[model samples]
Target: MKKKDNVDLLLIEEMREEEPSWTDYDMDETSVKVQLTDTVFDMLLNDTISSLRRIETRLT
Candidate 1:
């Protein structure tokens, strides 16, 4: 994707609404998988992971 597209997605993620339940668990595979059963969890997880990737890319 283009750099602008990446920035747009990052902004979208940053503005996303999160579930209170998502904060109840560690950012791990098991927790994520269990939460995958819920759309809220899945979207939040994907947004979080995407943000992390963006951070890593900038750091490198």
Candidate 2:
């Protein structure tokens, strides 16, 4: 597997391990929303990078 895939897998594993804590009663909805937004943003960023890589590969 590629280094990027390995990194993403590690991130996913870590997120799964820590996900429960983010839902604790003391945490507010706004915090959860922010986290979700951040996750979406990261996903979009990765998608953009992957798309660019694909385009570059095709061009080459």
Query: Which 10-residue window in model 2 sums to the lowest lDDT?
Result: 22-31
For model 1, the stretches where C-alpha displacement exceeds 4 angstroms are 1-37
Q: For candidate 2, lDDT tens digit of each residue in 1-60?
A: 699999999999999999989877665877889999999999999999999999999999
Residues 1-60, model 1: lDDT tens digits: 699999999887865655455675656777777776687877889999999999999999
- TM-score of every prediction relative to native: 0.39, 0.54
> By summed lDDT, which 10 consecutive residues of candidate 1 come out lowest?
17-26
* Candidate 1 pairs with clashing backbones: none
Backbone clash total, candidate 2: 0
- Estimate the TM-score for candidate 1: 0.39
lDDT of 2: 0.94
Largest lDDT belongs to which candidate? 2
